[model samples]
Target: MRQHLWMICASLALVTASSAMADNFGMAGCGLGSMVLQSNGKEQIFVGTTNGTSASQTFGITSGTSNCKDDAATVAAMYISVNQEALKRDIARGNGESISGLASILNCSDSDALGTSLQRNFGGIFQNTISDSKEVAVQIRQSVYSDTTLASSCKAI
Candidate 1:
């Protein structure tokens, strides 16, 4: 009787684990790190298995939380934080590759328009000591909500 109950419990655990994994494929290092799982929701850290977290850490650029920022949508948030100085320089330079790269990372549609908008709004959007990826992400996501065609073409990250 105990053996049968154990089998049933293991089966349920497998099913629950598989279900949680299905939620985010792109988030799993674009494809490779699927076997490993990460969830702060789980109290035990997947029964002390660090396989998934290690794989995620190995693939730094792919992990959304790679940058170690407080709040980030994905690795892109980390990129934004890391590149703040470069972005500031690019915005100051006016309509160029760095601005375009910034636009691409932020998921904006029009490179020129985003460059122009960031150039125009640099003073307000960026700050001296703040990385501001979360703040900028809020603005971009809000663009999807309130305004979609404001030349910047902000989209949800």
Candidate 2:
């Protein structure tokens, strides 16, 4: 009976250690410049743009889908498409001379401000669609902004 109790204690210790290791690794992997958050209350996952960087952009799901972990990649792809479209629009509208301006526009002064702008912009674009697929698209937009910033930052560094 004592041996069994010892074994159980050992198992619990292993589980605790494993979880700590996972958390540490996850944080380390994200690195210094990146931000990370899991969706908790709502189906929305917001990725806000970074400050003091021309790569500020916000990505989020306003309504429709919930629990976006399974489709992260797909959502990321869609964001790329949306950003491309936004770029084209910006160019046509004479907003800026180059794609870099799009980057600047996305890189608003603050993350929360960027998020508010994105919610307004994307809300209009995705108003008609249903939630599940639309949410994935929203995720894609967020991914585009985040990926673009990361890529640009890497190039700068």
User: Which candidate comes out best when scored by TM-score?
Assistant: 1
lDDT of 2 by residue, 41-150 (tens): 23112212221132322121222112112233443344435665553354334343323433344443333333333444554434443435445345425534554443
CA deviation > 4 Å runs, candidate 2? 21-109, 112-124, 129-147, 150-157
TM-score of 1: 0.50
lDDT of each: 0.52, 0.37
| True-vs-predicted CA distance for residue 33, candidate 1, Å | 11
Candidate 2 clashes between residue pairs 3 or more apart in a chain or in different chains: 56-106, 56-107, 64-131, 75-140, 79-140, 79-141
> What would the TM-score be for candidate 2 when compared with the true structure?
0.27
In terms of lDDT, which candidate is strongest?
1
lDDT of 1 by residue, 1-157 (tens): 9999998678657745664445332232322233333333452344233335466444543454432222225645566666667766776665777667756765677777666656666655554456466775454344333434643354534
Angstrom error of the Cα, residue 140, model 1: value is 8.1
- Listed in order, each prediction's TM-score against the native is 0.50, 0.27
